[model samples]
Target: MEFAGCSRGSSGRALALAICLLALISLSCAARLSASSRQKLDVHKHLNRLNKPAVKSIKSPDGDIIDCVHISQQPAFDHPYLKDHKIQMRPTYHPEGLFAENKVAESTKERVNTQLWHVNGRCPEDTIPVRRTKEDDILRASSMKHYGRKKQRTIPKSADPDLANESGHQHAIAYVNGDKYYGAKATINVWEPKIQQPNEFSLSQLWVLGGSFGEDLNSIEAGWQVSPDLYGDNNTRLFTYWTSDAYQATGCYNLLCSGFIQINNEIAMGASISPVSGVRGSQYDISILVWKDPKEGHWWMQFGNDYVLGYWPSYLFSYLADSASMVEWGGEVVNSEPDGQHTSTQMGSGRFPEEGFGKASYFRNIQVVDSSNNLKAPKGLGTFTEQPNCYDVRTGSNGDWGHYFYYGGPGKNSNCP
Candidate 1:
């Protein structure tokens, strides 16, 4: 009987231990599930904070992440509807349903009155006009809000060979006619050049303009850096631009990118372009646009050929109240150290050196459009049916628009006077 009792006691202890182990495991799983739920809720709350009702969470077909937003049809201050009259606002009967279709966030709607009427130069009858305004006041205001300024970086002449070209390699040219000032177009011929020192300088640059001596440079759209910044400032090449699928690399870098000016790394708006591991200089003849949106503290970079290069969002711009005094073009290095350990990108690499690595690229026709005319005409580079919007503002093909041409040396023809 004693032996039996002892055996029974041992069995009971083993069963109790097993039960405890199972209970611990179950409790651990529950805790994990609770944490996951909390994390998800936190993410949702943050997104809601953006207060953009137009945004919709979507799962990409390939399981990638993609979000969609509805374009608002309601006219803002600068739309054609508001061009002729002053705008005033009044509350609507059904505040919740007012912007239902447009999907503007609830928070945004609440901030401003539901019924707002925009006006032309004069104030609407009900509202008083402010002092010192013009017909183009709205446009000018928007431009200032969108395009601020650029940080300046004056490069020493001996920094990088490609960037420090003593022969005046770095340059910017634009049409000078007055009417063309708001909009201008010019045809430039790009010639391919044989690669010299094939690795150090790939003949690519960011175009800068302040009218050769002014204090502003236009941003390059869809720009990307590929080579690693190994020797620090010794390399001066930024590569690869494309407009479409068949339009591979620019064939050669001898055209507009013989040399480019370097300025402070301040960008009004910009994009990054990257080449794959095996691809080199396959696309060519590309155009880009940079614009600002005041409400959003971000600059935009657009890419395309005479036809189409999509717009990729880059959040690397700070708004400047003053105009950009300088524009930077090439990727010449001034130091031999790595550009700090840069963060990795899903798009591509920014470590490329102009002549050090593989093949690179070129750029041209750098121009600066003031806030007064940022949206009056397209930058003239994208794909537009009846001449580019840039050229649309032009009077015609010949001398109607002021023209600046950068022709490659020797056998190349610039197609300009």
Candidate 2:
């Protein structure tokens, strides 16, 4: 009888242990679900982010991990211009959505390629790009709210902790034509840079301006950069920025501002353009041309051949409203290296331009829009650098590339720092 009682006691203890194990497992699962529910990625309260069909998330050039969402209407700022046009959520020929209808048949034939966007300063579609302020997806960028603690400040935005909210673009640019600028064009290669700080990045791009480089500067900037400090991953992407008064209160990187508008979603400023880019020696570099319409007085930005993203309106700038005074093209790097050793942060490919073609990085066929709105090879080109040992430029003109140059060097070179 005693033996029988002991067996019953043992069984009771075993049952209690199992129940405890089950409870612990349930608690763990619930904790995971709760944490996931609290940590939502899309911080922009746009309605399109809710309960949408499962879409792939891509890394933005600046480093934010964003889920792709669709919009059928223009942002509130572009409402006036988009009133007459139907919104296009996907590219006509590209395939990424259930709504994407391929309109063109793929060609397998060999073909000759020519320049895109004849210097007429006309947008492919009749519509132009616009920007937004106060409330926009890109405004809440760095909504991961800055990864950790405070580190450094480049321009004293002591209160705004979000990297994007700060002076987002701290560039090391090369300039030409200080007062004779109309428009500028260049082809830039994209590369993923090593990012040490959330606010720092590396890229190759073009900056066209009209006013002085001081607080009154009016400019248009476009390029490709890898900013993990901003986006999340080091995915290189196309980017654009414009401001009537420097970068103070009027403009933003990509569509974060209220003046630039988008008609095609196939290739966007912040979206990953990786599938068709990044491979060297494959005729895959991005050709960007920003020219002003002498008649309409609008600045138009064009990408490659088929994609004309859109334009920034004339009334958007005080200085650029008339004409650009200067033009610039080259590589930029923001180094927030904490250990103080040069941030392995590369500007172009992290390789020296002396390495050449597939081995290094370069910009070819650099041109500018003349008064007649034609793409003309640059004349009397001159270059500038903040630090020659870390980054440099070499320009030349030829029958093939017209006027082009090779630039960029790894930060913290053996001879630099």
Candidate 3:
């Protein structure tokens, strides 16, 4: 009878323990569900903030939704300082000595680049096109708050070789410093470079930099890129980035943040550009010009020859408010190979600068705006690359192309590894 009693006690205790375990599991699941629910709510709230009301919506072939938001209601006005900002419809001063289009026409066999969204519909005059941010777009980010932001310390510093290697970013760039630059212009050769991983990207751009390359640096960037992580696709897209504090919290890519004011109803900031350059085929490039207004001190960007895209108000920057101290133009790629192997991602045309012409990507007509607001060939152009075996840059000048450089390469080869 005592043995029977002991057995009963043991069974009862076991059953109670089982019940306790089940209860804890249920509570844990409930907590997870609650947290997930809150996260969904926050994501929706962010989407609501970013995807402004549209006067019209056009679906592009590339699966992008372009929303025609009223110019006054753009995300730019969200900044507290810009609450009373009057939009500068046009730049007060235009840089002189723009490279003649006839020169490009006579030299290379090129095609015109257009945004995919233009095939469907057009936004009205008083509205600007904005790429609609979907829930999946935000969810693809490491976190909701970090969506559309470059990782910290992504920009290359010529002085800090160690920092560039640590950041996993490699560049083949042509830079000019030691002068007060008001603007920069480059006709960047665009390609849909293959990204080895979703987290990696390849781009060709121009950088207007100010201050030291430290935490307090200010930069304005414009170019074309293929970022699978940011856009959730492998399409080449037009992008712009700015950071008043070295990419920590100051800015975001394209129209993802509350800064650059867009006055043009055309050219969606994050939309895909079609007809990327092909191997040994017709080449395509886009001319990007970023300059500061001498009068208002606002920085302006012009796409191609026309299409004055927008401006970053003078107050958005500290060092750039006066002028840029340096300018860099060329290709950069993120090498995120986990196995210590070089990434196979391609930068620019994925062909080394030695390939030349249609076989390699090139930045032609590279010019910087002088203190007098006139665009002229940059002097003392210097090139830098972390690993020349992986990628490289070679510069040249001619009457037809002005100051030009052929750059980029396939990221990983026997030598690079």
Candidate 4:
């Protein structure tokens, strides 16, 4: 009876093992059915994607039909502006980052070639070659529109026909005594200096024209006037500069601190003369300041010496922010007196809270640098600073005007030839 019981127990154990195996097989079959159903669903979803309008066709290397239609859920070129645009895929030559260090060479052929179009940045000839396509025109059109209507529309004659005929370039168009002209002018001053405040001064970061800039009430035609009646004072010397014309306001006084030259108003890469005590104004180069900005494709203001002061992006406006459309070359003073009475409202004056350090001065040369030519230096006014030229020519015995006398130097030795 004991042997029979043991044998029955072993048989029962075997039967339990077989049941477990069958149960595992059944679970596996159910899992495989679930996986199959999932795969079918995925295939159905892909088929539904084929009906989308965004995708046009899909081609295979072996010339076999893949999905040939849009299988993507998101539509390409769905934007309202790009509804009519089409999408295409083709092998393209993109910089692999490995060859980026190498300088690309320019092609001798002017016509578009496969090799030339595929070339990348900064070729040996210093030109970037791009694949010629309709995209180029599109890019140009987009850029032209970026400046808005002001930049796109042509100028309509609003003034007299004679005046409009006299007007040439819209930029750097200088007017001297209500006359348009281009040249360099310089001047020297001899007067009593005033005592300045301990720390009162202003600094202008000129990104445009440079070379002696300041307001001199004693002299007119060059100094910038904040008001029609107001002029720089000698008593407080609040709204005045001596070194360069540009300055920063420190309260009610004008600080004759130095200005900085920046490249495109972004990169600081050049030197500037800072305002100091008894810093006698001299021929400071404004050319570098103008050239720096021009390198970034913009023109800067030139100073009394016909040198660039610095570049200002907003100078492109026909109307200046101050409503002063013209750049004055000399100084404008109240009653043409150094100790003139200050009466005009202080529009743009400031003073140092601590002490007086700076005063206003004058500016002379005014010219624009032509940036179209990519030369390293400024194109106009070859000299960095122009010497004093005679403004008041005296008629000689020979009936010819002496140009040298007006320049403040000794008259020319040679008679008029």
Q: Which ten residues in a row have the lowest lDDT in candidate 1?
A: 383-392
Off by over 4 Å in 4: 1-192, 195-261, 264-297, 301-309, 315-325, 333-417
Error of 4 at 300 (Å): 1.4
Best by lDDT: 3
Q: Write the per-residue lDDT of candidate 3 for residues 174-256, one digit (tens) a residue.
A: 99999899999998888999998998999999999999878889999999999988899999999999999999898999989
My TM-score estimates for the predictions, one after another, are 0.30, 0.65, 0.96, 0.21
lDDT of 4 by residue, 72-182 (tens): 122222223334433212112111221121121112112111111112211121111111112222223223222111111111112222332111201011122222121
Per-candidate clash tally: 52, 19, 0, 57
The global C-alpha lDDT for each of the candidates, from Candidate 1 onward, is: 0.25, 0.56, 0.90, 0.21
What does candidate 4 score in Cα RMSD to the true structure?
A: 28.5
lDDT of 2: 0.56
Ranking by TM-score: 3, 2, 1, 4
Give the Cα-based TM-score of candidate 4 against the true structure. Answer: 0.21
Candidate 3 Cα misplacement greater than 4 A, ranges: 1-8, 99-101, 105-110
Candidates 1 and 4 compared: the better one by TM-score is 1
